[model samples]
Structure formats: structure tokens, C-alpha cells
Target chain A: DAGITQSPRYKITETGRQVTLMCHQTWSHSYMFWYRQDLGHGLRLIYYSAAADITDKGEVPDGYVVSRSKTENFPLTLESATRSQTSVYFCASRVGGSSYEQYFGPGTRLTVT
Target chain B: AQSVAQPEDQVNVAEGNPLTVKCTYSVSGNPYLFWYVQYPNRGLQFLLKYITGDNLVKGSYGFEAEFNKSQTSFHLKKPSALVSDSALYFCAVRDAGNAGNMLTFGGGTRLMVKP
Candidate 1:
């Protein structure tokens, strides 16, 4: 209840369909990040927000979209899901700055068929 | 460009034996290195970090890491491995001066401690 949480722990979506994964953190951290964990690639950052309304693309951001309208919420949306996008997505939050450690949510397992 | 490399895909150690998981990094500037562990179907848990100061950094669950700046390596080590310590280990790095503060993660190494 006091840590980060992700909705729809497991999801299945058809190719070309739009899907969104929600992440919420109760810690009121200033930094939120979205990462996709895939076989052989480890965890690659997709998006990160320094604060509300401030966001930037990470390594693999082409197929993903993210928004942070509120400090506690940072949702990732896939405009058109692809089979390649099927992976476990994780949401993380940090208090402030690059030196701080991040806390991760359970993760959302998304399968694109 | 900043990046992390975990050379070993898997590590096997007997219970009560010392363990080491290798990790090396490359960055344009000074790096902030970190180690995290992940159990089945769970999120990554912070292990330890090497920011500045002492080369040996102690972290959670009796895990420790030694930072060798010259070698650009930060290897995770633990004495007396336990069966419960078997999990996926990740190494990450961030540029100290970068404003974005995004982290680059290694491919990960699966540690299996046999009893």
C-alpha cells in the first residue's frame, strides 16, 4: 500500500491494438521510470519523468509512449502493440536526482498476440 | 554512451561457498553503479551501489561490491552463499553528470546456489 504498484499484473493484447500499463507510487517521488525486461536484453529504459509534466525518451522508446500528469502516476501506452513488444514491463520511482536508489513495482507482463 | 555488461549468463555455487557475479561498465563520465536482485515474478530489489568514496560497498542481504575505477568494474560478492540467494542479478550504471539520470542495465546473470 505504501510502495509502488502496477495495475493488471498480466495482460494480453492483439497486435495493432492500443494498450496502456498504469504505475502508481505512494512515496511521492520526483522521478518515475518505465523499463521493459526482455530475454537477452535485460531491462531497457523506455521512458522517464523527472517531475510532473517533464518526461524524456529512453533507449527503446520508438514503440512506446508515456505521460506523467501527476507525480504519483506514470502510465505507458503502446500506440500499436507488436509481437516484439511482448515482455515484462517494470515501473520504478526514485526520490530525486541520479544518485538516489530506485524502487520497482511488481511489474506488468504484457503479451501481444 | 553509457552501458553495463554482465559477462556471465549463469553462476553456480555450493551453499556456504563465497560467490561473485561479475559486472563491468562504460560511461562518458563518472558512473554511479548499482546491483539489483530479482526473484521469480518479482521486481528488482536494490542490492548495493558504488557512487563515490570507498571501493568496497556493502549492501542488503550480506551482499557487497568492490568498485575498481581503473578497470571500470563493479563486481558483486557475497560470503557463504545460501540457497535463498539464488536469483537473477542485474548490474546498472548511470552517468554522474547526466541530467536525465537514466540507467543502463546489463543482460543479467542467474545465480544458482546448490545445497
Candidate 2:
């Protein structure tokens, strides 16, 4: 399909373990974003990439790393997961120019125990 | 910097009654506002957006939002509430000048519709 998709829709890992969430979009959108959704926080941006090799930090980027090696792929990695890091992660993409709305993926639910 | 606020944590409305979810935002440049609904265990779905032309924007599922620039509010509304309309609603804002495609989301409002 020509939509955004996230890998490992559900994941569980122990604290201090490293894990990665993969995001791929078939539309070849120039802008890809990673956001974490918590209980009280609707959605906080973790990282975003304007284009391949051009990434920037968002509101809550600490403890998370992201890279966009290809236009269709943007991966987020947690070096050492913590309980606080466990949340629903969403991947979104948007094409540049006149449109500003973003299309979101199904989301990945991560649990750190 | 851009920020969005959804004042009501939860809203209760009866089926066939009108419902409203409030949202306010602050941004440095021209504002691009959007509303999204998230069903349980699903990602956010884009509802409607207010870009430039009209102040009153109609969205999916018969939802509409009126953008009041002076008041800095984009409140979502529906003529008659439906049971299926109950979901977590979020309001997000992005500054038009922001080249990074960053959006600030509100805390979200849980809408409950009773039959």
C-alpha cells in the first residue's frame, strides 16, 4: 500500500536494553516525524527529518536517536530504554510545498519493564 | 515556538446533541491548525484543517472547526453527536514559517457520547 507503516506494532523490552522502531513510507514524503504519546501528553515530538540526512530535534528528543538514511525510511533507536521511555510511538510523513497535513502510521506500542 | 492547548480533559454529550471540543494555540507566524481523532489502540486520523481561505472548515465524519484568529482558537464541533464519535481528540498547530514540519499537540480531549 502507499501508506506509512511501522514495524513491530507491539514490542516489549527490559529496562536498559536497546531497541529500534522502524518507519517506512511509500509516498516518499520529504518530511518524516517521530512522536511519543503518553497518558497526559497527547503527542510529543521526539525527532523529525526534513530529508535524507537532514534531521532535527523536537520538543522531547532526549534519550532517543533518529536518522533518515533514505526518503522512505526513518528509524528511531533507544540506546537504553527506561520505564519512562515506554509509550506509543507514531510515525508521520508529509510532502513538502502547499500541503501541511501529515499522514500517520498505525503506531508501535513499546513496553519497558 | 508553537504550542497548543485543549482545555477540557473530557467532555460528555448525549447522542443527538451537539458537542464541542475546545482548542487554543500560539504560534509565531501564520498558523496552520489541524484536528485529529484517535480511536483506542490506533494512530491519530486527520479530521479537518484551517489553512487560509475560510474561517469555518468542515472535516471528516461531519465534524467542523471554526478558526478564530483574533481569539486564537480552533474549536471542533458536530451538529449531532454519535456514539462512534467518542474518541480522543487532539488539536495541533504548526507555524507556517517552520521549515522542519514540526507540530505542537494539545493534551487531548476525551469525548464521551452516551446513547
* TM of chain B, each: 0.98, 0.98
RMSD of each: 1.0, 1.2
Local error of candidate 2 at A112, Å?
A: 1.0
Per-candidate local distance difference test: 0.94, 0.94
Top TM-score prediction, candidate number = 1
TM-score of each: 0.97, 0.96
| Tens-place lDDT digits, model 1, residues A9-112 | 99999999999999999999999999999998899889999999999988899999899999999999999999999999999999985456888999999999
- What TM-score does candidate 2 reach? 0.96
User: Model 1, range B1-115, lDDT digits (tens) per residue?
Assistant: 8989999999999999999999999999999999999999999999988899999999999999999999999999998999999999999998887767688899999999999
Superposed model 2: Cα runs more than 4 Å off: none
Residue A106 miss distance in model 2 (angstroms): 1.2
